[model samples]
Target: MTITARDIQLKQFKVKFRGFDVQEVDFFLDQLAEGFTNLEIDNRRMAESLKNAKIEIEELKAREEKLKRAYQELKKNLVSLKDEAQSPSNQNTSRMIITEAQRESERILAEARTRVERLNDDIQDLMKQKEMIDDHIRKAIELGKAILKNNDCPTNYSEDNDLKVKHLRQIP
Candidate 1:
């Protein structure tokens, strides 16, 4: 059973001869009861904190929903305004709005084109880098093949020197 400091304080014992010390038992019980009381208080405080946090979260969610609804309402109003402006009775204003919207659309298109061009340029740069690396790899492979071929061929130094001298004589 749950015990509290007040329960310990209000406890009564019948006095009898040769009975166990009542005062010592009561003292220990009081200490244990006080500890239990503090633990209960702490548990209550933690529960309250959790409740507040949940309440705050719910409030934020409600506010977020309200803002989303407002945004949708604003979008609907903009559509309505556009429709009203396009009515047959408002030709001049409708034409003006159409022209402005077209200009804005063109500007947005131009900006998108510029961004696409920049992205394309970056892609081209990466392609060039990849091509350079491939070329270097091909050159290294060619050099390796040349080295292997040279190792297979036994060269006569005297014949090579004579050929080199003959080539020099033909150079003039």
Candidate 2:
């Protein structure tokens, strides 16, 4: 069982023959009680200190948790910021791509214009050839008519009248 200074101070012993000296034993007991009281005081002080230490540890742990949560939040924000930063570069890249496409479109349009010009030139050449062929056909018709007229094939035939001869013998 636990002993207290008060228990030690109030302790009694049955009187015995040839036992410890009464005054000396009493004085020793008194000194031992005083020592016990000092020890109890020290124990109480240590217990209080230990209780305070436990409270401080709990507070520190709570603060650490709060700081950890804050750190995690900051990390998440940093990641989000890092992701957000790429959009402008992507937009710039898209703009560059669009610009390139527009340039390519312009190049294609220029090529089409050149092709159209060449086709127009070819068409003009074809038109001239057609006119030349028509002139040749007309000249051949005129030559045939002149040969018939000069040979006295028909006396009624004239340039103003179309050839409506029904008989070849009508020509003299």
Candidate 3:
């Protein structure tokens, strides 16, 4: 059973001929009741704070799971692209394309890993990191589509080449 401040205030004590002074005992009881009231208020505030913290933690966990799934999907796509590039029929035409794509993907993956490390260090920027990761995935998908569309991967690759991958800068 929970003892409340009002219960303490309403407590009674039988008085004898030489028992303790009534006024002094009542004054002490009042002080004790006030202390208990303050403690209860503080306890309620702390409980609310704990509840909010738990909600934030659950949200962060869900975001982390989403990022993990996206990373796994990206990894699977890269493996498929590598396998396709290695086929005998397309070896000659896809050599340069494969080389360039590998380089670009590696660079993108490294940058992503770096961003993930930063995100781990500071959770407050997770929303921005999610947006950035989505942008990277979109670019990677577009690059793969372009590579598949262009069957003639010429040896004379240059910055002006339509198949050249454009480097994207991070948004502040």
Winner on lDDT between 2 and 3 is 3
The lDDT per prediction is 0.53, 0.53, 0.55
Collision count of model 2? 0
Off by over 4 Å in 1: 1-3, 15-19, 74-172
How many clashes does each candidate structure show, in the order listed? 0, 0, 0
Model 3: which ten-residue window has the lowest total lDDT? 163-172
lDDT of model 2 at position 107: 62
**Candidate 1 residues 67-107, lDDT tens each?**
55655665566576677877678867766765675565556
Model 1 TM-score? 0.38
After superposition, candidate 3 runs with Cα above 4 Å error: 81-172
Cα lDDT of model 3 by residue, 1-172, tens digit: 5566687688777876544456755775676677667666655664565555556666666666666676667667757766887888877656666567567666665665665555455444444454554454444434433432324333332223343433112111
Winning candidate number (lDDT): 3
Q: Record all residue pairs in model 3 with backbone atoms less than 3 Å apart, i.e. clashing.
A: none
lDDT of 2 by residue, 1-172 (tens): 5566687677776656544346644665676667667656655564565555556556655655665565566556555555665687766655555566556555655655555455456545545654554454444334333433334434444321344243222322
